[model samples]
Target: MKIYLAPMEGLLDHLLRDMLTRTPGVDICVTEFVRVSGSLLPNRTFQRIAPELLHGSRTPSGVPVRVQLLGSDPACLAENAAKLAELAPMAIDLNFGCPAKTVNRHRGGAVLLDEPELLHEIVSSVRRAVPAAVPVTAKMRLGYNDRTRMLDCAHALTSAGAAELVVHARTKADGYKPPAYWHEIGRIREAVTVPVIANGEIWAVDDYVQCQLESGCDDVMLGRGIVADPGLAARIKGLPAPDWDAIKPLLAAFWDDVLIYILPKYQAGRLKQWLNYLKRIHPEAGIAFEHIKTVKDADVIGAWLAEGCPVPAAEPGWTKA
Candidate 1:
């Protein structure tokens, strides 16, 4: 069974990719969607968003990272895929699963599920543009506002040459709600000959097991669940869970990476975001979050972390992404 780290816009950048992949069971990661509109994006844009491109499209942990593109235009998306192909990504993934209103309002993401023909055109055009050796895959929700056309949309993507598909198991209307309809993914998987990876609302080993039993998919992609517990995939694969002591150094290393990669103003929010997720699995993380929830200066947070902030002595020498 393959375990993939789901591409989460805004939250799952290369920094977290490196951090999360440090454990076990995470086979591949899709970079946060690189929005393509109007014309072909510069190679630097892909590089800036996914510097792993410069490292043979692999994260610091050596896990392969595939570049994902998001847009509505078939021809324009194709042209950009050709450009990104020059970088030799593991696979070129199209984004039809993002449910952000701004993305949907602009005719990107899950809204396109309403038009299976358009989805077909976009996937076919890009498949033709990219080298055949490089697989073209896609991720999508069950539908836009409903699951009425879920199977039709799955067939559309597969018939258009999408090598594999990931079904998020809910409609855009679901909006990250509970009770992801994994059975819906089973229906889509049965309809399509290609591999189907199940995603959405999987927060534990039990959830993973249930998702597999319900979706009939062995490969599963984890989203916020992995963020909440960096070692989630490892634990599901039967590795022992790291206690709070093991998590503290990652926080320090993450903060270190944030300082170098992001501006000082945005750095605190980055740490806070991970801490917020970590709080779900670590009580000390909850205390740390409370200590720095209102604090803006990253230096202050660093000082608090060095002093242990309830879970002290973050060991140094974490590999930076």
Candidate 2:
């Protein structure tokens, strides 16, 4: 099965991509969603989200990174998509899955799911704007308020020339709630001709099995799951889980990279947001989290995590969904 890394706005930056790619079974990485509206953003903005584009749309380890666009305007999106295509990304993914209230208020992200025809126009325009060699794909939730119009939206994107679709298996109202409803994703795959990737609440290898069985999709994309366990994708591919001895040195290396790349650039709170995920895999992460809660300095927090925080054990029968 193919394992694609989900684009988490704060957590999945270039440094994180470099860290995770060293682990096995990671096929592709989608950069954090880039908002497209009005004018195209500056080159540094695109370069920051997708530095891999500088390396010709692939990571130093040779893993491909796709740029994702989130917006409501077809004309603006198409224009910006063309500009980004010039940089030669591996692919362009449309985002109709984010449930952020600010984004929805602007008629972008999940709100677009409510307007299937408009979604078609946006996807079709973007598809036509880019070269044929550059694949255009989409990621979406079931619907805005309900799953009633989910398949219709999927069919709309597919017919509009979307090369692939990743269904998050939740409605806008659901908002990361329990029960991902992979069955609904299976229904979408049956309805559309393009490849469908099941995404939502997959935290472990067993959940991968259940999601595949339920959605009948050959690939799975992870968001929170990968954050919770860095070795998750590798484990799902039948590789041995990273033991504490191996995990320690790897996390130490990740801390060094984060301190150099992520800390100085972001505010203390944003840095803490990243540690909230990194702590999941590190030994003594709980202590590190407490340290982060009280410490405002990135260096202090990094020192705490590096000083050997005890890793929390995974709860029995735990699953992200």
Candidate 3:
């Protein structure tokens, strides 16, 4: 099955994408949605979100990165999509799945699910603007406030010429709560002709298996799961998980990459954010997070990481079958 990485707005930026894609089992990485507003965005704007476009649209490890756009305007979304296509992205993904209230209040993200025809118009416009070879895909939740229009939304996207559809199995009201409705994805997959990819709440190899079984989808997307455990994709594929010693270097490498690619002031927060996720899976990560959660200086965090967090020799009970 193909495993794609979800485009988590604040967490899964290009820097993190660079680190995760290098670990293997990640087929494609989508950029955080570039909000297309009143006018067509400039070339620089697209580049800022997806610098991989300049390098064959692939991460350094050669994984393809698709550019994702989020907006409510059909013409404006199409115009920006056309501009992004000019840069030769692996693919263009439309975001109809984001659940942020601020985004929804502005007529973007999951709120658009309430308007199926608008979804069709927006997808159709962009599909027509971009070259046929350049695939245009979309992501969406079950519905805005309920599942009343779930099939309609799925049909709208596919009928509008979307090459693929990714369904995050929850309504806007569900937010990031547990017990993702994986079975609900099966219903949508059965209703849509286009390839359906199931996403949401997949945290481990077992969760991946159960999601595929329940959703009836051959493909799956990883989000916060990957952030919490960098070796999850590998483990899902039956590859050995990276040992703590091996992971320490990757953390350092990520730090180095962030320092070089991002501004100094923003660097510490990024590392802290990643640590917050990591702590869920690694005890050592919890200790590390506590150590640097309050420190705003990137240099101090780097020094702490360089010293290495302590990881136990035995596997945690939660990881066993």
The candidate that achieves the highest TM-score relative to the unseen native structure = 1
Question: Which residue runs does candidate 3 get wrong by more than 4 Å?
Answer: 309-321
Alpha-carbon runs more than 4 Å astray in model 2: 263-275, 278-283, 291-293, 296-321
Report every candidate's CA lDDT.
Answer: 0.90, 0.82, 0.88
How do the residues 112-178 of candidate 3 rate in per-residue lDDT, one tens digit apiece? 9999999999999999999988999999999999999999999999999999999998899999898
Q: What is the per-residue lDDT of model 1 for residues 140-214, given as tens digits with 9 covering 90 to 100?
A: 999999999899999999999999999998899999999999999999999999999999999999999999999
Q: How does residue 39 of candidate 2 score in lDDT?
A: 88
Measured on C-alpha atoms, candidate 3 has an lDDT of 0.88
RMSD (CA, Å), candidate 3 to true, equals 5.5
Better model by lDDT, 2 or 3? Answer: 3
Error of 1 at 39 (Å): 1.1
The residue-by-residue lDDT of candidate 2 on 201-249, one tens digit each, is 9988899999999999879998888876778998899887665555556
lDDT minimum window of 10 residues, candidate 1:
312-321
Give the deviation of candidate 1 from the true structure as CA RMSD: 4.2
